[model samples]
Target: MGKLIENKWFLLLIIALTWGSSFILIKKSLLVFTPYEIGAIRVGVSGLLMAYIGIPALRKMSKKVLFWVILAGFFGNFFPMFLFPLAQTQVSSSLAGILDSLVPVFVLTFGFLFFGIRSRWIQFIGAIIGFIGAGSLMYFSEANREESQLFYAFLVVLATACYAVNALIIKEKLQDIPSLQLSSAVFSVWMVPSFIILVLSGFFQNFEASTPTYEALGYLGILTIMGTAVAMILYYKLIQNTSPVFASTVTYLLPLVAVIWGLLDGERFTIWYMVGGILILIGIYLIGKNKKPKLLS
Candidate 1:
């Protein structure tokens, strides 16, 4: 049992499952809480839970490191946290999950353009393919005619861009830090600010006690503890044990889990969705195909 827990494959599977389910959990939580409230609570609660580890890490962290950590936290965690819930309000959880597969594509694009990482022509083609898939998904969505819904889908795309930037930061700057310590410190940095936002969102004043409220709060709890905190820890551990590229392959499995959950929850799935999804996956495979795993410095 202990050995299984230490297995990298097991950890990867768990991360994929936890993160994939997070979209549905966000959907469930929105039944009672606003997107702002949900985002703030997720960060605040997860930050609080990690305080024990994060506080000490922060104390020992040099200001130089903290600067990058803070930047990473915002792009990686903060903005995406809010963008996703906002997008989910208009877009289905399944579609949001599908769009998230764009992270690798954006990472490749940003890496070449801004981070000075070189890419092959094939990778450029992959990026274009990825964009085409994303556009098609949005264009053929049930809400395609609705400008607001299309805008919301683009929000998810924007969140993926933020994630891509964060990924480059981690790879270029924070690779030397212990993964657990880095995650803890990042969460700790945003803890207070997030809670402040929670209060400003009127969560307390608007709070009520009812079965639906309790259920929504329960989903938020799971989203915080399992999806954000635990999944992040496991994801980082996977990076330490393997490579970022390998850890990121979790993206391949994540959409499948989300699609399953979305279907079970009665969300619509169309033929165009399948087509777009396949193109995105194929593009991702091409983007990652030429890259060999290099051990973190």
Candidate 2:
């Protein structure tokens, strides 16, 4: 983690593969489960899986630290877990990808507004520019021309804002916990509520997984472990290691990865898509550089 492994680009690559593909997985899972149902399972299963993996670290964490992890889970996973799937039902997977790029923008905004961190205008501008591309990509590639897409976009925005809140919470409240412990605890917390909702909602009462449904569940299961379980742990660690905006470079890279995955899978890309994607990339580059450049002493 010195000069070699812990580099920002390395972390970004990890995040790109993990979070970027999540929307694609979510699209598949939705072919069977309702958004609420998928939301419940993905978080519940991932939390349970990681809880076991992170046990020793969890035992080392203080109760005070434990609480922050729970809070992080609520904002980070719970809200977005439900929101993204619901949004995808109304929008294209590609649009979902672009919309998610706004997380860093909201993350930066929350950092300054709530945490009293000195505002970086350049960073904020970059964030906005990124969102501009993101929004355009989303708007143009929409699978549905219905008004529901607008509603879904708002929900995605809310989800991104939740990401911002989780960021500030992690920085100010959970700074003392080991990143792995924080990740485990938060994920574990998500399971309780998600399971409870799953039960109360009777989401699985019909429980019919056709072969394809079963395959979709398998995809979700893999996504739960890889995307939610493993990648989220890394994200928590990155937040601890760097500023939230720095951590949020994941947003920029992830969408491009999603775009590539979609394109390879035969999703069409138009001229507007290329133009919009380039704008988003430029915005990300600018926003990511806003952290005071570290000069070699």
Candidate 3:
């Protein structure tokens, strides 16, 4: 038991479950609170939860990297925190999960555009194929070309793009900092703003109004603490202990988890979703694979 508990693979599985469960929690949270409130509470609570560990790093952090930390906090945590809830309002949790897989593609795109990172021909082709799957998802959903839902789907895509940029910032600028410290500091920086917005938005008043609100908030708390804080700590450790390719497999696992949960919860599932999801997964596989394929044990 102890050996499995300490295993990196075990830890990765836990992180995958926690993160993949987050969308359903978000859906539950939205039942009682506005998307803004949900986003605010999610970030604010996650920030505060990590602050204890972050304080040590906070004191020792160099000013040289503070700007990057702040930028990461905004693009990585702040924007996506709100964007997911807002986007989920219009898009199904399953579809959102499918689209979220596009992060690596956007990561490569933004990396190439802003950081001068070059990709092989296959990576470019993979990205194009992935976007076509995304298009199929949008065009074929039951909403059926409703501009508003499509707009929200675009928001989710934009949020993934935000995630891509955050990945670049972490790789380029904050690589030296320990992942825990960097994440803690980033969330800590944004904590104040999220709290301010949360308060101004009157979450407490709404929170006290009903039993169902408390139930939903409880789920949100789990999402904030387990999903954001603990999963991030484990993710950083996973990256440290394993190859990037191994750690990146979580990208493939998350959608499966999300889609399964969505199905159980009675969210719409369609044949197009299956087709689009397979294409996106294949595209991701091609993008991640090199000329020489590596075997796993």
The TM-score, computed over Cα atoms with residue i paired to residue i, of candidate 2 is 0.86
User: Tens digits of per-residue lDDT for model 1 on 160-271?
Assistant: 8987887778877888888788888888889899999999999999899899999999999999899988887777667666644566667788889999999999999999
Model 2, 1-297: lDDT tens per residue? 555436767877888788999888988888888888888888888777777755666677778777777677789978889998998887666666766777677766666666666655677777778778766765665543566556776677688789888877987788777677777777777788889878876766878758987898898897888888788777877888787777877876777888887787677667666777677667767666665533222
Candidate 2, superposed: residue stretches over 4 Å from native: 1-7, 53-67, 138-144, 293-297
Off by over 4 Å in 3: 1-8, 143-148, 239-248, 291-297
Clash pairs detected, candidate 3: none
What TM-score fits each model? 0.94, 0.86, 0.90
RMSD of each: 2.4, 3.7, 3.9
For model 1, the superposed segments whose C-alpha errors exceed 4 Å read: 1-7, 293-297
Residue 60 error, candidate 1, Å: 1.1
| Ranking of models by lDDT | 1, 3, 2
lDDT of 3 at 293: 28
Better of 2 and 3 by TM-score: 3
